[model samples]
Target: MGDNDHSHPFFLHHSDHPNLVLVSKKLNGDNYTTWARGIHISLSVKNKLGFITGDIEEPSSSEDPDTHAAWRCCNDMILSWLLHSLKPELVESVLFSTTAQAVWDDLCERFSQSNIPRIFQLNRELATISQGTSFVSAYFTRLKGLWDELASYNEHCTCSYGAKNDRQ
Candidate 1:
């Protein structure tokens, strides 16, 4: 997706994390399931997957000052990255968040709704596709775009090797 390069730094904000692209704008949205999967993998890379899963808690002020500071820095960095990656309208909602997990949870709760109808609609369109009068290459490209978008909505096993195999 086009936004992948932008979201990379946020997930890799931690000095220890690997440098790699995450979700791009085209693959991120309420319309599909790819966003969640991409976020999961990104967080995993940073060893901060617990933030979204709620397995980890924000460090309290009463905790060790150094540990608390580090946690806050990491959370703030992640929140900043997420805020930067979102559309302007979406940014307003999570802009005030102090914890990265809070923003992630809010987004998930807001968009993770049943999308059965959208899936069916995409399927119907895919079924009706035809080369018609268009050149074969053009038709194939259009069909592949639809298939890629459809695949984004339906998460499946992703190959970790090769650019073409790595659908995420």
Candidate 2:
């Protein structure tokens, strides 16, 4: 397929496989924020984010047979990648999910907590964190990781504060 044609969601690189682990760290009941972020980046790079976001719907079997087969192939591939990225214990929970989105939503509901208590805990950790016996790089990495997770819990203002007021 041509470059433009191959950009479709159904298109998979020869190297792509169901057993591929999208992230170095598997989801182990904790570290969902970082793990999910890593998976999003990897899937986005593969042009498969839509599978988890429900943007790419499966074609009907009656629709063109080729199209239906292609969609099922891509869906199963994405599902396998998601399963491979989770810890063995966690995999059993999501193993039966038919779609990548179903597995994603299930995991998200189980681990994606952004409540006041969580935010306060992160802030407290940030305040007490120190280089201590750890190397400078390790300290910085830990601090940065906490900061990123906290930032993800925050909601950004969509209103344009810099825009000129019509009444002005």
Candidate 3:
């Protein structure tokens, strides 16, 4: 967990379990939730789910005898991985957070703006969007991207909530 040592072997998640997508170098505008989900699944596979779930409290010092030393180290490693995943511009904002859960919470708060006015504006734009003179395939691609963005923000389109929402 020391700043100078990058030798922590436990931090790397290289297995082919399917849901574990390595954090990308740059997480741009709307990719936060997707990135977070991947990180969560990967961490879960490592039995370190508590690091981001707030179940494991961050240790104040590695020297403290009562601390879960290995967990603390793993938590720091996870936080480091999360830091590496952020876009360079966003790194500064979350850097001050002490624990992985705090960082996760801060990111969720900042990026998960489901009730924001921008969602309404995006909806309006999508409703009025037309192919115009564009090629059919290109138009479809653009439309699909807009729909994906909408689904990411809308919450109900996600599989977890979709079933419950559908029954209502």
Model 2, CA-based lDDT: 0.77
| Per-residue lDDT of candidate 1, residues 1-65 (tens digit) | 13234343223332432223356652235543566666677667766666555566676778677
The better-scoring model by lDDT among 1 and 3 is: 3
Q: Please provide, for model 3 over 1-168, each residue's C-alpha lDDT reduced to its tens digit, 9 standing for 90 to 100.
A: 443333433343444233223565345647655676676666676666677766666555656644556556566777777777787788899888877787776776666553355567768989999999999999999999878766755552222223324323
State each model's C-alpha RMSD to the native: 9.8, 8.0, 8.5
Task: Write the residue-wise lDDT of candidate 2 on 45-164 in tens digits.
Answer: 998888887788877888678888888898999999999999899999988889888888778666665244677898999999999999999999999999986776542111123111
Worst 10 residues of 3 by lDDT: 156-165
Model 2 pairs whose backbones collide: none
The alpha-carbon root-mean-square deviation between model 1 and the true structure, to one decimal in Å, is 9.8
Output the TM-score of candidate 3. 0.54
The lDDT values for all models are 0.60, 0.77, 0.63
Supply the TM-score for candidate 1. Answer: 0.57
Tell me how many residue pairs clash in candidate 3.
0
- Candidates arranged by lDDT, highest first: 2, 3, 1
Model 3: runs farther than 4 Å from truth? Answer: 1-21, 59-66, 114-168
TM-score of 2: 0.74
